[model samples]
Target: MTKAQIRQTYDRIAHWYDLIEAIPEFLGVKILRRELLQRASGKVLEVAAGTGKNLRYYPKTCQITAADMSSAMLEIARSRADGLGLDITFLIMDAEALGLHDQSFDTVVSSLTLCTFPDPVAAILEMARVCRSNGRILLVEHGRSDRERLGRWQDRRAERHAARVGCHWNREPLKIVLKAGLKVIDARRAFFGIFHLIEAMS
Candidate 1:
């Protein structure tokens, strides 16, 4: 989809997105934010930061720039940031084509977001491109199952579900990060191997 179309699609879904995605989404965000906090330091860039769900978990001393493609989602994020008194810069930006300068941030974070990108590989490469050489990039995503049967099921359902909900279920995000030239420093699979926490160095 074009960027405009993607934005509109997400905007239309913004209000209902959190409500419909409450359970696994909440748990996943919680897990990811905790993991990110352990390694996060210095200036951070959070891509596709829908509704700023990860904002509260960030340390008060850290500076954060949160970006999302959808304006509606960002509107909600801005309100949440203001309500929490968290100083954050919110921008309407694309993941594949970040407008920031190279090596701009010490840490890059994406929580359950890679799977929704039309070109996840390019998005990840951009994350690495905008991160300092020693910076860490953390991701928590749901991917294709390791089990043959479940993997096949995800493969069969992913495209249709993606079409309906703007999310992909079968993305191999860990492999994509490695392919983007980041070195994997740590990885853990949870929720019956459906969810993953990956820490990579640029």
Candidate 2:
């Protein structure tokens, strides 16, 4: 999808996104976000920080810069930050082309966002690029399940799902990490191998 389409699609769904998240099916997602964000430290940047779902999980001592392409989404994130009494810097930015400095953050993070980027590799590279040499790139994401039957099901509905939700649910997070040449510090999976929690060094 074109950048405009992506921004527009997410903008339209920004409000509903959190509502859908409230469904019981997504409890695991919240658990994953909390588990990953708990590790964030020092200067942190969260790309595509949709609705600031990871905001409350941030450490009070950490400085956070939350970014996203959709302005509407960022608005929601800003409000969430305010309600949580967290001082966060919010910016509207395209994940593929972040307007941030290189090697500036001590920790770079993104959750459940890679699968939607039109160029997932470029996005991963951007995350790696902004992280300092010793900084970490942490992510908690869901992708194609290891099960063959589910893999086939994802393949069959991938196109339609992407068109509607602006995400490719069947992507392989490990492959994208490898393509980015990130040094894997740790990696694990949950939900029968559908959710990947990866921590890699830049």
Candidate 3:
């Protein structure tokens, strides 16, 4: 989708996105929050930070820059940050083309966001680009199942699903990260095989 279209689509859905995604999304992000604390330090950037779900989980001393393609989503994020007294900067930005300078952040985070990117690989490459040499990238995503039967089902259904929801379900995110020249330092799977938590360093 064009950037404007993507932004408009997400903006239209912003108010209801959290409500509809509450159950699985909330649990999944909570898991990511715990994992992020272990790897994130200093300045951090959260790409596709819809509604700032990770805001409360961030350490108080660490600076956070949360960016999303949709300004509507960032609005909710800003209010939440204000209410919580968290010093997070919310920007309207596309993950595939981050405007930040090189090596701007110590940690880059993407929680349940990779699948929504039209070009996951490019988005990740941008994440790595903005991170310092030794900085880490933390990702939590739900992807195609590893089981043969379910994997085939996901393959068959993913395009249609993506067309409808703006999210792809069958991406191999670990492969994308490694191909982007980041080394995986930690990884975990959950939710009977659909969810993943990956930590990598550039």
RMSD of 1: 1.4
Error of 2 at 1 (Å): 2.1
lDDT (0-100) at residue 23 of candidate 3?
Answer: 83
- Number of backbone-clashing residue pairs for each candidate, in the order shown: 0, 0, 0
Q: What TM value does model 1 have? A: 0.94
lDDT of every predicted structure (CA atoms): 0.86, 0.88, 0.85
Candidate 2, which segments miss by more than 4 Å at Cα?
24-27
How well does candidate 2 score on lDDT at residue 4?
91
In terms of lDDT, the best-performing candidate is 2
Instruction: Mark the 10 consecutive residues where model 2 has the least summed lDDT.
Output: 21-30
Give the CA lDDT, 0 to 100, for residue 78 in model 3.
93
Name the top TM-score candidate. Answer: 2
Tens digits of per-residue lDDT for model 3 on 1-202? 6567678888999999779778876556577667666568899999999988788777778899999989899999999999998888888888999999999999999988778887888999999999999998988888887787888999999989888777788887777777887899998777757788899988
Q: What's the TM-score of every candidate structure?
A: 0.94, 0.96, 0.94
Q: Is candidate 1 or candidate 2 better by lDDT?
A: 2
